[model samples]
Target: MNTTDNTPSNIVRNFMTALDSNELDTAANFLADDFVFSGWTPKPLNKQAFLTLLENIKEGIPGLSFNIHNVLEQNTSITGTIQVQGYQTDSFIIPALGTPPIPQTASSVSLPMEEVTYRLHDDLITAMDVEHTTGGGISGLLKQLGIELPLAQ
Candidate 1:
């Protein structure tokens, strides 16, 4: 690995690529110990919780991927847009939502562009916030899968 590969841009790209390829460990390495992940669920996820979500996604959608584009870097933050695509072949567990696992629908979903923001410190990602849209991101994906989420209390 190149020592100079720790640039903000490189780290974000590599991190997302690692996730797209289902290389969880590699992706984990890019996150800080106190990392927080948000927007994928109703609440932010701690490092371990986020990892668990990724594991669930991997199990549920074998070839799931994020097609990232329009990336921008400013200070210690990186922002980008990603289109999530996958086929639901197994149960999708979202612990942060406090809902039961989403059962398989045997359907393919291609979500619209969702903006992602990553804040880094000391070359590791400290926070990731995804922009959720009503007809995009996880909500839209679930809608496409024909599984409606109960209204939040």
Candidate 2:
């Protein structure tokens, strides 16, 4: 690991680490103001909304964890697999996805390592797109919990 303050991989690792550690304030520093995050919801979430989504995930999953691996950087883009595992033991709130919070479903999930791509610009994350497949990201996590969201018709 370069460990340099500005390295894309370093920045991304730090950001995810912060998120998994529930250090949202620290995580926010690594995101550009115009940051966009996808795959967690039907629509893309902006930086603030993305942070809120993480918060909701933490609150919903209680002890959810993130393990980032297989990071490969090419130009301004970084691709990696992030393994997210946890139990849905608490009510989850994601306004962009649904109105009221989802009650605890007493379900557990260990992702097969979702492939994530992060785009960096000027040392801040400009965009993050989680793998658009079953068993990846929040969408997959919800499915694992037996909660099916209404598809875009």
Candidate 3:
């Protein structure tokens, strides 16, 4: 799907493409002004903050890419599974963990499949939520970088 297309599925495809390509402007154009993003971080993110987080991820992870395996649309919502792969090229803190930025080791990590759900209104994405299907969530991703966290009580 093209970025100009506004259909729910198309918008999701374009948005993910733009994000994987680091095209912040194109990605932002697909979102509503009051868009809310949940997942990746502990707190929800608004449109501007979401864009900034995308930029930070792009900077921290060199060669970042998202491979979409499936997309399903129902009514105004679209859900899909994606595989995210990247190499850590610089020191960066885990937003979800809120720890100090860890030095880069140039380690390559391929996060397990994640499910993303996007809700659209008037052709613009208004809400997005992501969940890990397996691999222990954020901690699993961190494990790939040789960082381990204590198990939850």
Candidate 4:
């Protein structure tokens, strides 16, 4: 890739690396103060809210880690699949989905590679759109919900 393409991709990759390692402070550096984190739902969040949400996530997931499998960067946007792993003490709520009021309980469920799209401002990520693999279909949704009937085996 040319310099034009490499810059943003590297920035995003670095951001992901920082994020995956639970480096919120480092990740914040790559985010604009006006950063808007779209995709996470139940209620959309702006910058400060998103930061607060991340803090809550850090509390919930504890040692959460991420592995970005495949990333594709084009003009002002990057799309990719990412695998995330974390330990859940009590069931975590899925705010993005307007599902049952009750949060699903699971010790842990291996989630699929969630698709993520990032919109950049200059080199910093300004906004994002993330779609969990669960968005695929009923089966996908069930998988994320930790209802792997037979289990993946």
Task: Give the total clashing residue pairs for model 3.
Answer: 0
TM-score of each: 0.88, 0.88, 0.82, 0.69
Distance (Å) between predicted and true CA of 122, model 3?
Answer: 1.1
Evaluate model 1: give its lDDT: 0.83
Lowest-sum lDDT 10-residue window in model 4: 93-102
As for candidate 1, its clashing pairs are none
CA lDDT, every prediction?
Answer: 0.83, 0.83, 0.77, 0.62
**Clashes by residue pair, model 2:** none
> Model 3, which residues run further than 4 Å from truth?
1-4, 93-97, 134-139, 148-153
Instruction: Evaluate model 1: give its TM-score.
Output: 0.88
- Residue-pair clashes per candidate: 0, 0, 0, 0
lDDT of 4 by residue, 1-153 (tens): 567544877888888888777778898888877788755343456766766655554555656565776788788898877666666554443333423332435444345677888889877888866774554322343345554323221
Between 2 and 4, whose TM-score is larger?
A: 2
Q: Which candidate, 3 or 4, has the higher lDDT?
A: 3
Q: Each model's RMSD to truth, in Å? A: 2.0, 2.4, 3.2, 6.7
Better of 1 and 4 by lDDT: 1
Tens-place lDDT digits, model 2, residues 14-45: 89889888899999999999999987567888
